[model samples]
Target: MLWGALPYMVIVFCITATIWRYVTNPFSWTSKSSEMLEKRLLRWGSLLFHIGIFAVICGHIAGLLVPIEFYHWIGLSDEAYHMGAVFGGLPAGIIAFAGLVILLVRRYTARRVRATSSVGDWLALAMLIIVIVTGILATSANAVNHSGFDYRTTINPWLRGLLVFQPDPALMQTVPMNFKVHILLTFVLYCVFPFTRLVHMLSMPLGYLRRSYVLYRRRDGAIYPNQNQEQQKERAM
Candidate 1:
């Protein structure tokens, strides 16, 4: 019964929070990069995390959104599909988790970044890591089993039903614990997102193609030479 209500509840909660966030603080919809404080680790970590996450999202779209019949229709067997997911999911999860670790380390080690960090940042990162770890646990467990947990049979229908405004809690109730935990955490993330920097995901700059380039210039009256002695050697003599 709990599972039955959770889907609709989370959907409503996310929708309401999103609406409120957009209305109250539209200007705060940013990821708030700390590139100026530290760029080297940030560059690699951000790249890996984004790439892995994009792949993971794509994988979920293929698995959850696409029905089993579609695969069979395209001459793909269930076993083949499961094998593909096992191979694809493991590396993606690892990459994403590794990147998150790097980002977290950078946040703690860099003085400027650590000074600006908030509780929201830590909470968001912790939840994200939990979601990824649970996901990988589910995938790796299924890979070792004699038969993979065919989520398309259970979780997929339930999710599709939800998309059409129908809630089928029974479908998710039987899902493996790891996968269920992953799903529940995901919904929880929806609730927390509006209050955190995670909202930046929704506001990604899709208009970049049409936007003009930003120009930045260093302010004058600021000393550029690292050593004042170099510029004032004559005065020293």
Candidate 2:
């Protein structure tokens, strides 16, 4: 049931919830930046978290979507591929988890940020921490044990089958316990994604291309003589 039914259910829930949220309250779809309250931690944490997570995502895509045969055809041996995965993925996961921890700490320890945070914000951070920790455990275990448990033969195929609607539960039956936990938690994260600020990840700044240029002025400075007229013109345009 975990391998077969849960994935599809989460996918449907994510898609439906995302659409519903968009239609119901489009203006609420923002990351709600707190840079004004605290800049030091936020700058470092946001930078590391985004960079590491992007790398981790790219690794998952290459590992799961691409076939083993293709790698072998390209003259890459199985041992070499696994080595690269461990060396590359382990660091990326560690970096992302570290960044998330920093961000979580900043959120609670900073007074202004904490006051503004909602339950949904805490839920998102908690879910992310769980998922990243499990992923790190899974990768670290494989790196130390070198158990020859080649996931390309099992988990990769299972996930690809899921994409095509022909998932085989047997493929996941023998997967390592840590890997199973990570996979399940990942889907759980997806289920919570649309309802959290994480939804902002799906947004793009395309509107900036056509939107009017923003006007800025010093808070205590005198207003420009034509500021009102310029504002009126932009609104009319």
Q: Candidate 2: minimum summed lDDT over ten consecutive residues — where?
A: 218-227
Task: Quantify all predictions' global Cα lDDT against the true fold.
Answer: 0.84, 0.90
Summarize candidate 2's per-residue lDDT along 1-237 as a digit string, tens digits. Answer: 789998999999999999999999999899999999999999988988998899999999999889889999999999889889999998998889888999999999999999999988999999998998898899889889978887888999999999999989999888999999999899989999999999999989899999997655646442544456666677577
Query: Which 10-residue span in candidate 1 carries the lowest summed lDDT?
Result: 217-226
Backbone clashes in each candidate structure, one number apiece? 0, 0
How would you encode candidate 1's per-residue C-alpha lDDT over 23-101 as one tens digit per residue?
Answer: 9888877788899999988998899899999999999999999998999999998878887998898899999999998
* Predicted candidate 2, C-alpha RMSD: 4.8
TM-score per candidate: 0.86, 0.90
lDDT for model 1: 0.84
Question: What is the total number of backbone clashes in candidate 1?
Answer: 0
Q: Give the Cα error of residue 230 in candidate 2, in Å.
A: 16
TM-score of candidate 2 to 2 decimals: 0.90
